[model samples]
Target chain A: MSDIKARVSFLGKSANILIWLLLIGACAFVVTPLLFMFSASFMPAIDIMKLPYPWVSDHIHRQNYWNGLRGPDGSFVFLRNTLNSLIVALAVTITTVLLSSLSGYGLAKFRFKGRNAVFMLIMATMMIPFETIMIPLYMVSMKMGLQDSYAGLIVPFLTNAFGVFLMRQFLLTFPDEVLDAARIDGASEPRIFTHIVLPNSGPAIATLAILTFRSQWDNLLWPLLVVQSDEMKTIPLYITKFMAETHSDEGIMMAVAAMASLPMFILFFTMSKYFISTEGLHSTIKG
Target chain B: MQYNKRFSMEQKKAVWGWIFVAPSLLFFLVFSFYPIFNAIYMSFFKKNLLSLKPPEFVGWGNYVYLFHSKTFWQSVSNTAVFTIGTFIPLVVFSLMLAVFIVSRPRFQKFFQMALYSPAALSSVVAALIWLLIFDPRGLANQTLNTLMRTSGVNYHWLSSSSMLRLSTIIVYFWKYVGYFTVVFVAGIGGIPDYLHEAALIDGADSWKDFWHITFPLLKPTTLLVSVMVMIQCLKTFSTQYLFSTSGAPTRPIDVITLSIYNTAIKDHNIGRASAMSVLLFLVMLILTWLQLRIAKTEDVTYN
Candidate 1:
């Protein structure tokens, strides 16, 4: 009886170990490309396409990193583009969060005719893919003389349905008593939002900010459509153009990718816990 | 008299709401709704870049052309296959991972963080990383070759057309699994522990308990996840463009969105592309509405 119990225990332990191994193996599979990308950024152009094996040189070509930093003509185009992307992303985040919060507060706190209709309209917009309207939107931008400008890139995406939806969801949970107290104190509607509501909704605001920033930073197609000049190129477009121009220079391409991804990686690493928790917050608002 | 008081309050509220939501509504109309209507209108025209003539109203010409085009049908089939291929495996793996991680509460946090990290990375970045791996001499093939040396059988994972599609689907699953897993974990966590406790006391096995207790409770979450996944699959373009070769056996892997992009931007056939986009939109809208209806039914049953 003791032997049988021991056997069962051993089998369970083995099964658990197998499960761990399988999980780890799957993770390794997913991580392989990212790992290779980092390593290949250090390899020479000729070596990049070569089969990575035991024969593959372990030597790191440091020049690839240097060449990546210094452009073909020794210009700071890549760095400038990186900075451009950062500024645009930050601007997008700030505008989106502030506007969405204000709008969300208005929708949530105010009782008015067609309030539900307005909210429904915003929600409906969320389903419309940008691809469906790319041409006319581009034409409109050109007609407004906003072509090749940051204003053009920023304006269309400034007020997102998703951000408004998220903020509305958060604001719904705001207690009516808090607003009543503020009203009783003779605070104006805008003042109540600024002093009372905004101060209290830090987590939701942060989550919206992160999501907005990430979306803008990684936005490719729209930015590609709008930004024409090299000066206006965001990081993704910069990297894509760089890849096309320097097709043979894998090292440089990888280096640029690393640089492009670094800021977002830092932001994500720092705020991942908050981001994960916000999923629960979404459920609460959704519920 | 009571109705008058309520009406006044509602009026005040409505004014505030409209004032606050005005900017969003304006942008939504200009950038979203107007564009959609414009695209629908454009779909009926025969417009070209060189010919600045008034768009010749050709009702259903673009749509008819789209239906007749082999590439369009091919794109539809590819999208369906890609959607189904990625969706099923992704949902299953994510649920399993969530369940496993949640089963052991001690290491749950670590597992959750590890799994969720990939989701934080953008789809573009994720695609780039996978492209590197699935390149001919890249890590995936290298590792496979090393493993196969003992048996003397080598395999090309990405070079072959079918394998390329399969590989792309796998990458899609890998990138999105964490996102759905996080959703599932949140959903599972929301399930009250009392139900599970009662089931345990009733002598239910783990699987039986999950079937009876956990599954029913997760209906809303499953609905939400399914809707999001379906929409996501519909919008998939960048990864396919990045990974697949431009022409030939691999060329057929181009999905509907990519085809629309090719037609509009590359081929400069904006009218036809707009037609395809309108069709795609309608299909997605119908699918979403159906899912919501089903979810409503499930909500009623479960509650």
Candidate 2:
């Protein structure tokens, strides 16, 4: 009996070791491409393309960065593309925070007719794919004279359903007595929101800001449809060559990709906890 | 008199609610609801893009043309194949990965952070990484050749039909498989520890315990992850769009999003694109409805 018990313990230990090995192996698999891209961005054009697989550059070369920024034919500037993206992302984030918090506060605090219907409508919008609405939104932008302008790129996405949903779900748990106390002290609703509610909802606001910024920063499709000029082109457009004048060179591709992804890596690494927090995210449909 | 005082307070509350919600409602009306309705309306007309001519009324003509068009059919089939191929393996592997992370408590955060690092990458960047791996004599092929002890395997990752499809699937899976893993881990983490202890006390082994306790309890997370993954896969455009334009065969990778993009922007056909959008809209509506229905029937298993 003692011998059998000892054998079982040995088996359990081996299984534990195997699980750890598998876990590390999967982590490497997940992280390798990003690391490879970062490393490959430093490699020269010849080393990037030639065989024997240069995993690391023999000598660091920064020309790829210059080549990428100089555009494919050396006829354009990549800074403009990045600037366009930054402007759109920042606009969307600030607007989303303001609009979503106000509306989410309304949905959570007020006892009003049609409140349920309004909330349901906003939640339902999350399910609708953008492809369904692209053409009509495109037409609307053109008719409103927003095409090829910053307004066209940023206006449609300024406020999103997900932000409202996130904000509302979070504010639902907020104490009602605090607002009542503010009201009794003669604070108006807007004043109450600006002073009392906004200060308390810091975590939700941060979550929304990070999420909004990350998504808008990575936005591709809508911008692809609206922008027409070389000056208005975004990062994905450069790599995909939708607005560019020449095909992407192999080294330039790595460089542009690395540049495009750097801001997000910083954001995700710093806000890793918020990005994967599962409370309001996974349990959206609460019982 | 008493009724008047109570009713006035309720009215004041109602007015305040509308005041706060007005901006968001107006934004949605113009951007979300109105555009959806307009997309439906535009599907029935023949509107020439880049022309001042008024749209001609041709009810079902665009839809009919789409039904007969070989390119549209190919795109629909490609989308279906991409959705099914990518989603199943992704959902299963991510769930297993989540379970593994949950079992090992010591390095849970470490593995979670490592696995989820790729979720932040844009699809364009994700595809660019794989583009290297799929090159003729690139590292992926080289590694496989070395493993099999063969030289110059010469598989066409981008050029061939089947291989091109597989390459796109790999790119997507690499980017998002970690994301869903984190979601599942969160779901599994929410399960209380007492149940596992009870199972162990009742002589249940690790595999049997997971099958009985963890898997059943994860229904909500599984539903949420599957729905999100399905919609995301259906709406995938960047990888497919970037792949074809960057020299892969456009036909095999022509997803519906890419098709809509080309029709509207490239060929200047708004009506045809609107027709396709309406169909996609209907499909998403059904998927979402299915998720809601399934979620409602589960009846709060934990409580």
Task: Identify the leading candidate in terms of DockQ.
Answer: 2
Docking class of 2: acceptable
Per-residue C-alpha lDDT of model 2 across residues A192-243, encoded as one tens digit per residue:
9999989999988887887778777777898888888878877766566722
Q: What is the C-alpha RMSD of each candidate to the true structure, in Å?
A: 4.7, 4.0
Listed in order, each prediction's TM-score against the native is 0.90, 0.93
> In order, what DockQ does each candidate have?
0.37, 0.45
Residue B45 shift from truth in candidate 2, angstroms? 1.0
Q: Which residue segments of model 1 deviate by more than 4 Å?
A: A1-11, A46-57, A280-287, B1-13, B147-158, B244-250, B290-303
Q: Estimate, for each residue in A183-238, the C-alpha lDDT of model 1 and write its tens digit.
A: 77878777888899999999888888887887788787777778898888887777
- lDDT, each prediction: 0.73, 0.81
TM-score leader: 2
Please give, for residues B172-263, the per-residue lDDT of candidate 2 as tens digits: 89888777887787777666666766776787777777778879898777876787678778888888887787788899999999999899
Candidate 2 regions exceeding 4 Å error are A1-14, A72-76, A242-248, A279-287, B1-7, B294-301
> Chain A TM-scores, one per candidate?
0.89, 0.88
